[model samples]
Target: MTSLQHVSTISAPLPAPSRQPFALALSILLTAGLTGYLFNAQDSHASLVLLLGAALGITLYHASFGFTTAWRTFITTGRGKAIRAQMLMLAVAVCLFFPALSAGELFGQPVNGFVRPLSVSVLFGAFIFGIGMQIGNGCASGNLYHAGGGQLRAIPSMIGFAAGALWATRDYEWWTTQPSLAPVGLIDMMGVVPAIILNLLVFAAIAGLTRHLEKRRHGELERDDNGSDQPWSRRLLSGPWPFIWGAVALAVLNFATLALIGRPWAVALGYPLWGAKAAEAMNLGLDVDFWGYWLMPGRDTALMGGILEDSASLMNIGVILGALMAATLAGRFSLSWKMPVLQWLAAIIGGLMLGYGATIAFGCNIGAYFGGIASGSLHGWLWLVAAFAGSFVGTWLRPLFGFSRT
Candidate 1:
């Protein structure tokens, strides 16, 4: 193809010049601010570790998705380098959380207050979440990242997501009031260490099996014109390690947030809040009732409830800033909007599902799946299974609706 043709075909939307710089600076400022906030607010060292793990997870996620070269290489070669990074993240989380179980503390604080959901509830929520993410074309975190990257489709998806979350929040009281719903915790398990070991074993077995299958099928395929032969080491270092480090840093920040804030980190609550606010503005009068009764609880309301109920919103904003900063610095900001109509609809539906499911599950991919698994909660694993099953079903059905796999 000619140079002009190539450029035209690959062109994506670019963030405004002023917004680009603002996004970068804002990201840095938020990281610093949140970190300081967490340190001052939390008391647990384990919570600090969790915050660090979360940061690492976000960084790796960005590196895996935002970097076109790395992503392309992985796609061409079918390598697990990115997946390995995720696995390592889970490993670190498992290691850190298991010990906290035995000690009955997270970062040296009591863990009794953190609530867990029943397996059945988690599974049901996961199924809904899976379908939502499939339709939405991204999960909670995924939406923020894509939006920051200038995907216009994400805008509508997020709107739908907020609407769904608002609906769920309005109905949260009735849902939690159900007899089948009860707060659960991992302390009732055989302690954290055993749980960690078991999880590690399972992860190892799965990794080994996956590796074996890839080797058998591809026979160490070399990089071809299809861009498959990139060295693993090169791929690992191609993107900014600082970005990855930033994600790890976010994890540490989250731990501090939990200790200080008395709740795990999250990023979906904001959607619901926005939904509620919008409804209120429209004279629906949903905000006062929803915020007063279901969202806020206890006499120390301002100090405690605000932090837990609003953590997801804060995190969601941070994610957008973070991704924007990463993209701008790398000169990768694009405003491209070329998705088909079907994909757009899918994204909207997915966002709605994610909002509703996350509220019911009491978390999203980050809170329920990642945090739950890290805490050695069985519910986290169950969510993963259900979500994955849903993802597979979504993938299979996508062709029927003209959504192609990336």
Candidate 2:
């Protein structure tokens, strides 16, 4: 869902040769074993989903397509290049998804886009998520790929995500009382062409606005594209890819997801389900009917099922493994086992916020922001505005965590 920026162009400007054969071997073995398990445990579709997740991870890693970093850079430096990428990604996804969704099927399977209710929860959740991104230093998808690339900090954030997600889901028994608008689909409400035109107009306006701001602030979109002289083949296999490619890959894969799974891309839904499974293992007397969301749309089954049975979970695994493979091939795998207390605390706190905010908001950067907007849900637009505002405030708070400029 990135949005990337001048802050850290994807892949760290052609990563220096930093290979680990052991890591490479381990990654290969892990990928093979997982693929085998999925094929045997469920079916080819499950294995395919896992492979797609890995592809997402690889594309995200090599391209360094990041939502949190991109938005943070914009908030602090007024660089809108990454934000532009985010817009482009959304536009591409909508262009592909809307038509298929309107058609109601792809290859004989029913197709649908994410269209959650616009609610007070979205307002609160998105704003908190914005602030959380600053503290966490990564969005939901960002953490998965980064963790795979050996960023130890993301591990704690992930743990916190599970905690926050479970907590909020468990607490939603009361939160559901908040007001919400009935769900609406632009295609159904105003027809597909009009919806596309309206969304494109918004996208163009934003892009234009950002270009103006970037010029007024930094005189132009900042770039390091010319700084690197890496060979094309090397860049393709073991290095930094341009952000545009990341956007393209995400759009294509999301479309493939629709064709394969009958839905657009999503990542965070797996968090709570994982937590529920954990609670059940601990004999916490977890009930599927404790909160209504779990019972809606066959979610209870996904909650009770194994990881391989959940599309989002399988995709998440693929993303992590894909990032690992990409990092290994690019020779950029490094894990630090040490961290300052404040930073660690920030990571944990931020992660909890990410989980809570996203859960309550109905999705994270991926689900709510990307999938929501692509699905033509108005709440996604609201999520963007609130999250951006929160990010603005978060930039100021970053200094407290020893972050020079988050």
TM-score of each candidate structure, all chains considered together: 0.72, 0.94
Question: What is the TM-score (0 to 1) of candidate 2?
Answer: 0.94
lDDT by residue for model 1 (97-143), tens: 55654565665566422347664546666777776666566677666
lDDT of 2 by residue, 315-374 (tens): 999999998888788776777546678878888988898888888998988888888888
Candidate 2, residue 48: lDDT: 93
- Off by more than 4 A, model 2: 1-18, 224-228, 285-289
* Best candidate, lDDT: 2
- lDDT measured at residue 283 in model 2 versus the true structure, 0 to 100: 85
